[model samples]
Target: MDVWKLNLRHLRSVAMTVRLGNLKAVAKKINLSQPAVTQSIIKIEEWFGAQFFVRHPSGMHPTEFANVLSPRIEMALNLIGSNRVTSTQARAFLSLSKTGSYVAASRDIGISQPSLHRNVADLQSVLNFKLVEPRGRGIALTPKGISVARKFLLARLQLEAGFSEIYALLGKETGHISIGAMPLSRASLLPSVLVAFQKRHPHITISVVEGGHGELIEPVRDGHLDIIIGAIREHPIGKDLIQIPLFTDQPVVIGRKDHPLTKVFEKNACCQNSQIMKLAHYPWYMPGKGAPINVVWRELFNRVPVDIPNIPIMGGSVMMIRQLLLETDGLTLLSPDQVAVELEADWLVQICTVPEWMQRDIGITYRTNWHPTRAQSYLLELLNHHSRK
Candidate 1:
């Protein structure tokens, strides 16, 4: 018989009824009249040309055919849920994206005896439908139910393969990679790199987490995060921390175009004078607490200005800081590399390069003992290769 005529709804109904012990309960669960549930049972029996359920005063019960069809019902439900091993939904199903409870899956899928009862009861109510007549402790699939589930599984596999191929084109086909970065780098550079990586090796799956340098490093040490991109600070705690330099930053002093400091340049001038204090009066933008740049600035200046108390003035968003520089005379210190395009565009003019007293390095970092995934290794190789260029 052509199973194409059978539908998942019918299979689901049959699977649910078999698990719930009574048609009355199934009727209540599926929000259908008991008569409607009875009609489904009749139509299924007619299509299958088999007596699948044995009715009794206590409740309906499954026959020999029902026992044979149970496994097929399970496969069908799994296919729909993308739990068939290849669907993107499989990521959520396997508890990789998050956690999936055994009780929840058992109840929903009707693959286990106890869970099947509750799941069917719950599912029938939500779907407002019914399919199987329960018989004692056993359940059976109507012939149509078996046929429908098999068809669904086949179709699901084909659909999953199609999506798999698309992701494969982007390097997600063979491995997994986890990355750690700040929000700006995460939003800009990393996405571009991911797009490039995907084009080269389509089957790899990518994951990301964003946080501070010290906060992000621990994940790298435990083998959770594969690589991190940030300005170097303290080495990650423990002997296992490994790091590879991506690039270094050249420090620069930046101010709004109208700021007096922008026009006045005395090479090797210290920033701690009455004129400089007047310059600092123009709302200085700073990096956040504990950031390497902030720490260095505090140590060199030896005192935090009580004048600019707003924390938004100290943020990591390079673009926002640049925009503030364009619209206001907020002073900010930045890495020359990150500001190159702006400097070239004349949107910003460097007020000062670092005096010999201050400079810092920026680089891509990873744990020492950790090994990178193929995709991760590929990206690092590309970044390193391009840094030299």
Candidate 2:
């Protein structure tokens, strides 16, 4: 229908009449007589081959079609009014304009400037308006451009106010925090910390994910996780990352409570070669290779003066490993915390007579350069406080 033939004046008249609800008021506001205002509506209706108003004795009211046109007309008026502004000046009004070259919007939005400019062009086509123009050296907005900038400023103000409230609420512990944890630290350490945090800030939401060393730490480095509780080896700290030692774990050797080794070992005797062979026949449970506990076992086994392959039975869950230790004549390598329940019940007995070689260290690791949110910082403080006691 060649909609470009439609003028902003006609669109504004329609919108004002819809907004004001009667011809006399719209006429007074636009400094036009009542008949002139009525003619403008008639002209627009004829141009579009549609009815825009339904006349009555009390006043003139916009028809259903006129109601539909109001928002588009409002937008048209904005574009027409802001048509005289420079692109820089319009950006200042929109509050999203970048400094330096105009192309920087692509960087801010993570796209190229040409792409954003294309999007702006698409919007102008739909609105049937021109938003910006080049002066001698730089771009300027037409009167319609000024109008667009004013409407954009109003919207930006409302948006900024909403984000400010969200930021403030996050500071107040009203938002959610998700944490990832390594297996060794999950059960005993995290439960205590979570209980304390929930008591103090019941409004904050909390979630925890449990995984192994290789499975968990990358999310922290990529900014997907706020904090992580994983073990760090002494030598492998990566670039642009930091680590903090939380609490250390001492590894222990365990076996079925009634096994013969329970009665045979002296306080510090090396695990006997014959006795190791006897236990090796039973299902052996070991942590994954390269794990700190596994590394300790590798070192200790090499020094034993034996040529065994050093392979142990593999059970993934601590609970399952503990069950095997209780019901069968098997050996399981574990941290003390993994067997707390069994130790309390005497279902599993510590075979402490092994050479001092079996003891290993465990600790919590996290990114060093992370700038934690308020909830995250609060949780870390809770962890620190509890670890001390």
Candidate 3:
């Protein structure tokens, strides 16, 4: 169901009916006439093609569908944080906030610019807050507007989840999980889990968006992504986000198969300080600063009292780093799992493993308040099972 098209007032009435258990009470609570509340319930039930309330002589009793969907509706209403905001106003402001221009928002939403402006203005008037302001060419949201937008997006996610759960209850598989994948997760961990998950739940849709942690964190926080998989951060991020460690990935120094370091490791079983110092002469390829591997590289060289190797390229692209390693005498610190194919193909060789203390925790990050549907929970279970293997 396209949740944005549904009336917020009707949905709120549904939630209130679940709580109050009678149309008269629900109508009084929401300031609607009893017949209007009855009509609202009828409309919602018709839209879903299911009965939410079982009418009785005593009062209206909720059916199983209502029991499953009511909590989600409540959560969504709480996130929206207002009783006066209509679905049209929410849609209009969200469109404007996303496109950042009245003209573009109108074009995207298929409404005239004046109508879009009026809708947004009505929204701001109801909330009594400044949402947008004129920029050089377009408009920008105020800080308060951005916060409200995040909450509205989260509310939308909740409504979608509610309907998806309803579909599941009716023996329909229609859940979606959006993932933000970092470089390490993309190589093997995520693919294996996804394959296993798809086999078990073929109808569920899975989307994997690849990017660095810095680029993906905000989207996940804003409900655009369900979760992010990668190396866990060293310090505390905040209470709003939670991390689950799936496994620990040890860092390894890697180079092209025929590089000079391959010969150095061939003769020595253990890498000593001298062997480590030998790495100072070659150009290095590291991920951008603050990456787990980059931090380990800095620590490894800092302990040797040798000048840090010059880094010619800094990025998180494993393919690009592999090509650079094969073309030049450049070494990189990375998880061996990230380049398993290259190692198997004899294109790259692990020169030495970093100390066990240097191992980083690889895992999943998600919002603290997120309530995963059954399908999402199943995928997370698959990820944990595959990561352990």
Lowest summed lDDT window (length 10), candidate 1: 90-99
Per-model TM-score, in order, reads 0.50, 0.53, 0.96
By summed lDDT, the worst window of 10 consecutive residues in model 2 runs over 156-165
lDDT of 2 by residue, 234-278 (tens): 677687566677766666668777866677755334467665554
lDDT assessment of candidate 3: 0.88
Off by over 4 Å in 1: 1-172, 183-199, 205-210, 218-224, 266-279, 303-312, 367-369
**On a 0 to 100 scale, what is the lDDT of residue 252 in model 2?**
65
For candidate 1, the TM-score is: 0.50
**Per-residue lDDT of candidate 3, residues 1-389 (tens digit):** 56888898888888899999988989889999999999998988998888999999888899988988889999998998889898888888888989999999999888899999999999889889999999999999999999989999899899999999888888886878999999999989899899889997898888999998888889999999999999989888889899999999877888898998786675324456787788888999888887877887788878877888999888889899999999999998888888998999989988876677788899999999899988898989998999889
Model 1: lDDT of residue 263: 57
lDDT of 1 by residue, 272-340 (tens): 534344554566677787787776655544443434333346777777888988887777777655666
Give me the overall lDDT of model 1: 0.56
Stretches off by above 4 angstroms in model 3 are: 267-270
Measured by lDDT, the strongest candidate is 3
Better of 1 and 3 by TM-score: 3
Residue 50: error of model 1 in Å?
42
Among all candidates shown, the one with the greatest TM-score: 3
